[model samples]
Target chain A: MHVSFQVQAGDFSNAGKVSSTVKGILKQLNLGPAHIKRIIVALYEAEVNVVAHSYGGTITCEVEPESVDIMVCDTGPGIPDLDLAMTEGWSTATPEVREMGFGAGMGLANIRKNTDRLAIDTGEDKPTRIHMCFDLADGATHA
Target chain B: MTLRDVVQIVDGTVLCGDDNLGREVHLGFASDLMSDVLTLLADDILLITGLSNNQAIRTAEMSDILQILFVRNKRPTKTMLDLAKEHGITIITTPYSMFRSSGLLFSKGLQPVY
Candidate 1:
């Protein structure tokens, strides 16, 4: 089964809703605990990015017996420097978002650490798309 | 350590899912950064933090944490409690500072999540 959603910026009230829904679906699909955890973590980081940066965006998840693939896309200020953006402890999130317990510059790194395969494509203020896959066996992806 | 032990150490008031106090937690993460908690391997974890936002509950719920400890007597509002209830997570309030509450847990053999 595949799941997708639109994530909106500054929509704190419903920020995590997409991730929660994906969690329920993954649980119902009988995905293993480790795999499910990876999916949820990646989903959350993507969702948080949309809320904190983009005006709003879409999240799509493709689930197979072997793996789960997720894509989070948004029309926000695209990463000026993808390398820096991918670094741990780097963040461009505003103070308000930080106060809400997010924007620690850990979103992409956390997603990479949790998922098995990650690919990113972005252009400033254009659409930024992050593609991540978590293997069912290990729930880890490098680079 | 278990949620019950954390509760006992902090002298915290149970806000929800008190029945789950018996659940065991393998590790604890103390942080106000939801993203930091997200970096943890989401298995049998406990969250201790001073953050009172709804995001804290949401993050814990997604991570399937066994318990939440809001230190410094920072009680969660009715909305936050409801969120915790919906996620089947136990929330406890301790008058102790965040450092003290987590310190007590560490002394009691609760491992920290890296």
Candidate 2:
């Protein structure tokens, strides 16, 4: 199965909608609870990153019987340094964003922790693309 | 601990999910950073935060946290409360600071989310 969602920039109110939807779908698929939680955590962090940093974005999920592939592409000021942006305490979020309880710079770290594999492609003037994969079989082992 | 016990310990007022007070929570995490909250692996945890925004509710929903305790007398906005209600998350507020709230709950036998 496949699902797509649009994420709006600075749309904190609707930030987790996509993750929530995907989580419900995963539950319906009878994915293990631990696997569902990991996938949702990664997806939610990615979705929030788009809302927090990008102008907007699109999230595509391709769910196979054994794995889930997720891609998030955003039109915004792309990251200048992937390594630096991946750091846990480095963030460029506005003060207002921090006030809302985000912008701690752990979004990417959390995504990395939850996903089996992650890839990132970005440029200063181009859009940011993040692809993540979660192995259902591997996740089931942790359950 | 039961959410009802938490409310009594923190002297909190239930802003939403009154029916959920009977629910049990195994751990407590206190943070204003949504990212920090996301890193928590445990479920059925109680989040104590000073932030009273929709993102806090959204983070709790995403992290599978069962209840939220807003400290320092912070109250969530109408929109935030609505979102919490929609997610079936219990929201409680206490006049205590985040430290005091967490300390109270800890003293009352709430475990850490580590």
Candidate 3:
């Protein structure tokens, strides 16, 4: 089964809703706990980026018995410094996002750590698209 | 230590999963930051937090945390409690602040996952 969702920017109130839904689906599909975990972490970080940076965008997950393909697309002010943005402590989150217990700049790293494969496309005003692959063979590739 | 030990140490009110108090929690992650919780790695851990929301349950779900201890009397919404129930995660609330709760747990030998 496949599921797609729109992730709105600054919608911190419901940021994790999409990822949570995806997780439930994976569980019902009988995916291994390891695979489900990677999918959860990757999709969650991507969702956070959507709300923290983009003006809103979409998160589409193509779920199959073999693997789950997740793509997060955002159309907001693009990252000017990809290198800096990837740093652990780098953050552009608002005070409110921080107050809600987020924005420590660990999203991308967490995604990379959890996922089996990762792809990125970005530029100034150019929507950032994050493509992540999680194989059903126990996504146990954590740091 | 056991979930029961954590409850007693923090003076927490059990919200759900009373039957599983015998469950054990080998580690603890004390952060309201969902991001940190997501990235943290541990097994049989009890998550202690100040953030009372559905996301807290979501984090617990992803991390395989069996229990959630909300410090400072942060009452989770009905929706949050229901979500935790679905995940089989025990929820507890306490008047103790985050620091005090965590300190007590740590003193009792529940170290951070990191």
Assess every candidate by TM-score: 0.92, 0.94, 0.89
Off by over 4 Å in 1: A137-143
DockQ of all predictions against the true structure, Cα-based: 0.84, 0.83, 0.64
Best by lDDT: 2
- For candidate 2, please provide the TM-score of chain A on its own: 0.94
| lDDT (Cα, 0-100) at B2 in candidate 3 | 89
Error of 3 at A61 (Å): 1.5
CA shift at A45, candidate 2, in angstroms? 1.1
Q: DockQ-based ranking, best first? A: 1, 2, 3
lDDT (C-alpha) at residue B104 in model 1: 89
Looking at model 3, the pairs that clash are none
TM-score for chain B of all predictions? 0.94, 0.97, 0.95
> Candidate 1: which pairs clash?
A90-A105, A115-A141, A116-A140, A116-A141
Model 1 is docked with a DockQ of: 0.84
Ranking the candidates on lDDT from highest down gives: 2, 1, 3
Which ranges of candidate 3 are over 4 A from the true structure? Answer: A137-143
True contacts recovered per prediction = 0.82, 0.87, 0.64
Best by DockQ: 1
Cα lDDT of model 3 by residue, A1-143, tens digit: 66889887887767788988887887787776767776788888788788877888998988765677888888867887777888888888888778767789888878888888898888777888889987766533221
> Mind giving the per-residue lDDT tens digits that candidate 2 earns over A59-104?
9999888899999999968999989989989888888778877788
Candidate-wise lDDT, in order:
0.84, 0.88, 0.82
Error of model 2, residue A128, in angstroms: 0.8
